[model samples]
Target: MTVSSTSPSAQSSATRTQTSAAVSVSSETALPTSETKQAILTQPLFVYNPEYIAFLNKSLATRSPEEILEWALISLPGLVQTTAFGLTGLVILDMINKIRNRRQLAEHPVPLIFIDTLYHFQETLDVAKRASEKYDAPLQVYHPQGHDNVASFESHHGQELWKTDADVYDYVVKVEPGRRAAIENNAQVLITGRRRSQGASRAAIPILEIDSGVTPAVLKLNVLADWDYARVWKYVQENGVPYNVLHDRNYKSIGDWHSTQPTAESEGERDGRWKGEAKTECGLHKDYFKMRANYLAAAKKRKLTESTDFVLVDSEEPSSKKIDS
Candidate 1:
């Protein structure tokens, strides 16, 4: 669901309507009807309500990331930012700090949500730790189910889950945990570091969008949607933000250590991710509900089959159980 184009003042009023019975907006004038106020409140989107998407796309078209974030903090209640602490994520983290510092706000408006897949490189975990301390942003870290480290995670899910099934890999490690974090924290809106220039499925990301990607879709905003890698890198460098040390070694977009690889400039920004596969997104930006259902089904099948399969005492010595049984 989306709103139609309206003046900034009128849109600002629409934001107030979401919270109160009064149809109060920016200017003194009121909108025509009580029904108009109801429509604004009833929309599926949490953040995109007051301003039409077109209005946001055009008005915020030239605004800096800081400007966009400022509007977001004011407009959306229960806002949270999720990241993997990649270069773009670091850039936004710095912007959040700068915006809050300028407003003289005692507390950060949006808390950070960092999902620990338990398969992340040690460097990625280090970056998350350093970013939380550096920005002093209220940080919320969510790990996969009950696992905190690789050895435990591997024991729960078979070794190299990604190589076995990328869908299950994503559902367990990213999609489920991300959704859980949002709900657990009461996150009404999720701001991300996605940029249109990231290429592939991410090439068409919008400035503000309803993430129909997940069931019970959440409102998402790509504050840096207009930026490219160069812009993000420049911001990170100038601000001296904490970033994963692996980026210096050519890991462009870090996920698990197994999936990521170094990329030449010619290979494009996200080519190093899920390398050699046609896949671009790691199911986080896709339909996660569909993937979860499939993963569970496959796991059930595996469990039933494993119970019947006889283990070999040695490579040359099979169990005495009948092969047919």
Candidate 2:
């Protein structure tokens, strides 16, 4: 699919409100009851909420990356800044610290959330430590329940699950745990450093958004949705922001050690990730429907294999029924 990238300047308040109202209209029309809205308000916004996409699109349209960041801080009072310890997100954190410093919001600075897939690089862990200290903000880390470390994970699910079953690996490592963490933390909004120029999947990203079924919150801000690689680098240089050292080695996007790879000068960034595959995200920011469909496809394939094996076993049974006359 040819996806178009939207810059934040393309959004307007009128457009945002109208889009939100349209969502409200569609939602109410579908439900035909005030009680439904109330019920939905309590649940994740994206579950049935239309405004989530509206906001994502609008914010990315109207504001600059920096402006979107400011709005995220202002719009979501109970916002939680989340990241997979990637380069782009770190830039947001750097800017956030600067904003907080200038505004004297140090006492209640925004907190950072990490999924801690337990397969990250030592450098990533070290960067997390350095970042937490630098920002002087609360750091909440979450990991998969059963698998606490890499060795444990490998022992449970043979090594190279990414190659064998990438979707499952993504769901367990990134998607589900992220949802749980946000919910448990009682987050009203989430701030991500996702930018449109990153890849095919994220091209149409909006700046301000609701998480739809993915998150219970009313808003999930992609504060830098429009930022290109050049702008990101420029911002970092201008602010003297500390970043993960991996970027120097052509690792544009950083994730768990097993999943990420460096890009070559000619191949373009994001090449190493999901190499030889059309996949971009690791079941994180894409729509819930897509993620579910992928999971189901993988599950069905596995089931089919099992069914075939069962048939073969039954056929191979020696004289079980005396040739079944």
RMSD in angstroms, all models?
12.0, 13.5
Off by over 4 Å in 2: 1-62, 287-325
Instruction: TM-score each candidate.
Output: 0.78, 0.71
Query: Candidate 2: deviation at residue 30, Å?
Result: 37
lDDT, candidate 2, equals 0.62
Which structure among the candidates has the greatest TM-score? 1
**Candidate 2, 236-319: lDDT as tens digits:** 778777778988888877877876899887775677787777887777675655665676576576552221111222233321
On a 0 to 100 scale, what is the lDDT of residue 85 in model 1?
A: 91
**Which candidate number would show the highest lDDT if scored against the true structure?**
1
In model 2, state the lDDT of residue 276. 77
User: For candidate 1, which ten residues in a row score worst on lDDT?
Assistant: 316-325
What is the lDDT of every predicted structure here?
A: 0.69, 0.62
